[model samples]
Target chain A: MNEALTLLSFGEHGWGDTIAIGALVTVSLALASLPFGLALGFLLALAKKSAEPSLKLAANIYTTIFRGLPELLTLFLVYFGVQIGFQKALKLIGIETYFEVNSFVAGMFALSFVFSSYASEAFLSAFRGIPQGQFEGGQALGLSRKQTMTFIILPQLVRLALPALGNLWLILLKETALVSTIGLADLMREAGIAARVTKEAFLFFGVACLIYLILAIISSTGLARLERWSKRGDTAR
Target chain B: MTVVSSDTALPPPPPLPRRWTKARILGHVLMALWIVSGASLLFYLVTNINSPFVQKYWPDYVDGFLVTLQIVSVSLLIGALLSLPIAAARASRWKVLSAPAYAYVYFFRGTPLLAQTFLVYYGAGGFRTELEAIGLWTFFREAWYCVIFTFSLNTSAYQAEILRGAILNVPKGQWEGAAALGLSQPVTFFKVILPQALMVALRPYGNEIILMIKGSAIASIVTVFDLMGETRRAYSRTYDFQAYIWAAVIYLMMVETLRRVWDRLEMRLTRHLKR
Candidate 1:
């Protein structure tokens, strides 16, 4: 029908523009959270490998608790939980302006926190696979511990971690859809509004699905290439 | 990056020159900061536990908790049951049997579950008048059915993958032995292959179930009065956003209990494999 076409058309009445922007937001947020997640994961891995018993226990608890909990619940805790914590802190400073946490920032932090827990384990496993002899060689050359970790251990770890890190990125990309519940103007949220407004729920939702599928396919292809590149040496035999 | 030789069975690195001196200090400092933050949050949560609003709304909170468990458990059971056949289908050598199941898994796994839920709930909602004309409107009319359907399908995709991986991990020699015994294909699958695959699949399936339990929170968006639904209601009405913290605690406890159950199941399944 004409109505369905109009509903889906890229014209002013259509949601084609809104949905495109929403998809971009989702991708950006996922990318923005990646480095943050990687840094946190690296620290957690380090903590777990630390000699201090307390530090190791804390790291274990962090990963266990976050990985075990649901992503939605974790989002609630981070979004609302962080707001409550910040407000309480503000109360101490005697400054209250009804300032609210930005949904995008809160959403990114929540996701990165969850992503880090999984990433740390992957990174740790990969780091462990690196020959300790490399570190020993670096140490014998009068290299500082930090230099050894950076120059010797990390390069090998990156090679091993690439495939896993790519997979985590894929998961993170999909997980970003959950943020729509908190009123972020991501693809899902935008589609939800358009569906409600036009009452052509199928039209808007189908578009959303297509957008997500496109994003997923593109990212997956890139990830597959990275995975293949990482495994190039193994294929020679 | 260089690929080291397999013969290089390297010894552990010597103690870092300064040992754990700076690193340990920095580690302690960083660890202490995180622990303090976590402890403070716990303290805040506990102190607010006795608020009058908590006492008044305790029943609603409990209702939400129960609803969460109900949705999660049902969807997981339904999903698991559905996935077993789909997984078997995926493992089938026949292209006719495998292709459709493979596509199903790919589509579901390729997209976010949240999008799938919306497409089903809202997209299906658009066909309401037509659906009502048929006998199936009764099922589609209820939010519960929509939530359960969406979740079951999503989890089925994941479960199928897990099952496929587990099936692949089964040794080829076992299948040969089953053939040597002159067992029929179905008998081999049910008796020999399934038993082994089930052992490997159980732990991952347990994790999936727990994930579903937590995922049920999303069902609230579609008017399902699950735990997250109830928590949202409590927060909006009383302006006590801290109610989410309580919900989080309940979810944490559920996950912890599931972890213990998963550990036990893993131990039980692998007992024979243990040296």
Candidate 2:
């Protein structure tokens, strides 16, 4: 027990600080991807619901491919495939310079792709939950379409979409661990280093799991509270 | 009955006005840009055959594909079996039975599969001597076995939840009707309720199976030569992007095929319910 404590201590001999930084990376990755992902997801939802058949079909195909593919594969594709493609494009444009995509950027791009695909589904359902009359009512107010979306529809959409999106956030938090494979010093990777060096694989891995569990618990409770707050206006309509 | 049809039929409802909505305009611009840029991407991938990449790694990719299939299928089979009792316990009236079941599900569902896998695979090393003494080291020592073990446990939780929900949704009347018929509880569950519950679970089961297929890629990380593992080897050898793209194509095809097959299976199973 004392050995375990000393091994995890924050000093030169200990690995606590490294693991703490990893946890921060994990949280930051998830947080940083949120706005971009949400924006893309909203656009995807719009495309899927659009009157244009081709647009809808394209959106469907995009979501299907993104969601069905493994996150690991997606990460690798962004890491390797995008780099190669980008280089080739640059070459074609008459510029030649050796470049590499950062692992963090690749991870973010892949996570956003996956996140948006799932989020689009939630957004689509939320859009459905609103009555058509809501849109018509917006028009009745002589509000421009964009104005109506910003002032009226979006607030309601956020409420209806909150539970599903909140669940996705939990999924995303865990998914950040995948970035560790690409060499991001995330929680999993830090523990991995600690385990390898100390030969206490169980202790370190167990600690990692505990940290993830705590984060998941905290997120769930926060989301539950947010759900209630979002539904404050909801009643026996 | 209406002889004035041709002349009086309200002047073919004045052709609806083209709104030229902002969204439509944006969609058009996006379409044009994609047609120029994204279309080229699709064209290149579909037509540009990297023969050397394919010829060199095709066999390896095939082997990896089989391994992936074997992992997903074997683990899912075991997971389904494990989930049966778990689902029962979760549905049980006894707090003792249900509470542990709930905790098991929550822990597995809460954490990432990769970490659970690391815990099982490397954590086994921490207990090498104990495992060896118990004659279980041989099993735990194999990366393949560890992966299957972790996957089975992870998937079992999801399967259990699906089953518990399905069983609960079987309706109060079925249980009452079975009891009124003098059918014992176990017999009723086995003969009547289970079949109905299974039908309700069919779609979710299909989804779980697809998820397992996608997830099996992680098995490669532990040195199991699964599809992703094979792709990684190919990319390392050539530094070619086509290897990963091809793997993605294969995965997409597998998922699409299963989706269609599942749809057909669902329709066939529920044929009686159709009008």
Candidate 3:
């Protein structure tokens, strides 16, 4: 017991601090990607709904390609392919500056790209679910198109989209672990390093799994509360 | 009044002038640029495939594809079998039977599969002594078995939930009718409920298969020479970025094919309900 405690203790020799920091990195990665993904998803949903054939096709292709590919492959493409492509493009444009696509950035790009595809689907369905009368009613009340969207449409869309978005959030949190494959010092990577160093793979990995479960449980509870809050108006109706 | 009608006829609506709006023009330009970039990227990939390195490594990728198929099929078969009892337990009236099953599903679904894989693969090393004593050390030590073990367990949780949902989705009327016929509980479930529940489950089962195909890519990290593993190997040897693209294409093909087949299967299974 004493030895195990020493192994997990935070100090110059122990990995407790490192693993904690890794957990923080994991959280930040998820948070950083969430808004970017949501914005892209909103845009994609709009594009898909647009009258223009080209715009709709573009959005369709984007979602299909991203959604069809595995997340790890996407990460590799961004981490290696995009970095090289960017540098090459810069050179052609007479720029001598060097740019590196770090694992965190690559992971963020890949995950957000994946998240946006699914989110767009969720948003599209939610948009379809809104009653046509709501829009007509807003117009009948003399509300402009923009006003109708903001006051009448967006709120209801949020309520409709919340559950699917919550599921995506949970998935995004889990996907942060994939960044470890690209050498990001996220929770899994930190656990791996510690395990290798201490020759205690079971203990470190067990700890890592526990940390992930705790995070998952906390997020799920929060999501449930959010769901209830979003649906509060339903009970009154 | 009749003479005034011709002159007041709105002048043929001025031919509905074809003025371009700023937003319309911008949308068109953005769409064109997107298409151009996408086409050029594909063009580059197609033209670059003539490399000698790609030719030499093509066989390795084919072998890796087979390995990936093998892993996914085996694990899914085992997972489907294991999910049956667990799903039963999850839906049982007895709390003693249900709680542990619920916990298993919750934990496995809540956390990432990668973490679970690591725990099983690396963590099993700690149990080398006990595993050896049970004559299972050889299986536990190999990365292949570790991946299969982890994947089967992980997928069982998901499959169990799918099964439970399908079972619950059966109409209450069906159960009542079965009971009215004086059928035994097990008989009602097996004869009446199970077939209909299975029909409902077909789509989700197909979805699970697709997810497993994608998830199995993680096995490459554990040194399983799956498709992704071979991609990494090829990339290291030739420094060819296109190697990853090739693997992605293959995965995309497999997923798309599976999706279409699954859709057809669902339609066939549920055809009676359709008009």
Candidate 4:
């Protein structure tokens, strides 16, 4: 027990620092991708709902391809295939520098792409749930398209989208663990290293699992509160 | 705007011609370009199907597919069986029976399956002495057993939650109806509640199975020669990007086919509920 404690101690000889940094990396990776994903998802939803058949088709194909693929395969394709393609393109353009995608960037890009595909579906359904009369009402009040979107549609869309988005966030958090496979020094990777160095796989992995559970529990509670807060206006109605 | 005005205007102006805006024209052009590029890429891959590298590595992918199927099937079967008792425990009114069940589900669901896999696979090595004493060391030492164990445990938690939810979804009137019919508790539950709960749980169970199929790809990272593992190996050998593409296509086909079959099954099972 003392040996295990020492192994986990926050000292130069211990892995506490590495594991902490790994956890931070995992959180940051998820955070960095969230906005990109949500924005793209919003765009995709709009494209899907647009009157233009071409735009709708494009959005359908995009979501289908991304959603159909596994997350790890997507990561690998982006990391390896894109890197190779990009380097070749650069070479053709007479750029000699070797450009490679770091694991974090690859993970962020792949995960965001996957997240957007799923989130687009959520956003589309939420958009569909809005009454047509609400849009007509906005128009009757002389609201510009932008104003109607921002002031009228978005607020309600958000309330509808929040629960699904929260669930997506949870999935995203867990997915950060997959980044470890691509050699990212995230919490899972750090635990792996600690396990290898100390031959204490049980201890380190157990610690990692506990950390993930803590994050999940905290986030779940926060999400529950957010859901309640979002519905407060509804309760009054 | 024009349509509204036309209702008040003379003769409705021939229903106004369909006008394509600049954005619409641009969208059409871009969509055409996208389809052309996608088709060309597919054509390139098809033409290269007979390439020597692909010919050599194709069998590896097939083997990997078989291994993946085997692992997923066995683990799912074991997981479904294991989930029933856990679900029963979770649904129990007694705290003593439910608390540990709740903890199991919570811990398993909260953490990533990768962590659980590592804890089982690598962690078992750390307890070789204790395992050997209990004659379980040989099982832990093998990656196959470890993967099966971890996958089963991880999936059982999700399955138990689905089952418990289904059990609760069986209406209270069901219990009353059973009691009024002079049925014992066990007979009522097995005959009435279980069937209804199972019906309600079918869609979620299908979703869980789909998730497990995707989740099983992680087993490749642990050196199991699953489809993803073969894809990785093929990529390393030939530096061909199509290897990953092939694996992705296979996975896509599996998921899509499973979803369709599940939907059909759900429709058939719940047909009685529909008017």
Put down candidate 3 lDDT per residue, B138-185, tens digits, no spaces: 999999999999999999999999999999999999999999999999
Please say which candidate is ahead in DockQ: 1 or 2. 2
lDDT of 4 by residue, B98-152 (tens): 9999999999998999999999999999999999999999999888889999999
lDDT of 2 by residue, A1-237 (tens): 999998888979888899889888988999988888999999999998889766776688789889889999999888877788788999999999777888788999999999999999999999999899989999999999899899889999999999999989999999998999989889999999999989999999999998999999999999999998888888635
**True-structure Cα RMSD, model 1:** 6.4
**Model 2 - which docking category?**
medium
In model 2 chain B, the worst 10-residue window by lDDT is B41-50
The regions of model 3 sitting more than 4 angstroms off are A93-99, B1-34
How do the residues A1-237 of candidate 4 rate in per-residue lDDT, one tens digit apiece? 999888998988889999999999988999999999999999989888988788888888888778777788889989988788888899999997777889999999999999999899999999999999989999999999889999999999998999999989988999889999989999999999999999999999999999999898889999999989887889987
Candidate 2 per-residue lDDT, tens place, B1-275, comes to 85786766677678888777766676677667667766776776767565777878899999999999999999999999999999989989999999999999999999999999999999999999999999999999999999999999999999999999999989989999999999999999999999999999999999999989988998988999999999999888898787888899899989899999999999999998799
TM-score of predicted chain B versus true chain B for each candidate: 0.87, 0.89, 0.88, 0.89
Give DockQ for candidates 1 onward, in order: 0.50, 0.65, 0.62, 0.64
Tell me the whole-model lDDT of each prediction, alpha carbons only: 0.85, 0.91, 0.90, 0.91
- Residue pairs with clashing backbones, model 3: none
Which CAPRI category fits model 3? medium
Candidate 4 off by > 4 Å: A94-97, B1-18, B21-30
Q: Taking the tens digit of each residue's C-alpha lDDT, what string does model 1 give over A183-229? A: 78998888889899988888888778777777888988998887788
List interface RMSDs for the candidates, in order.
2.1, 1.7, 1.7, 1.7
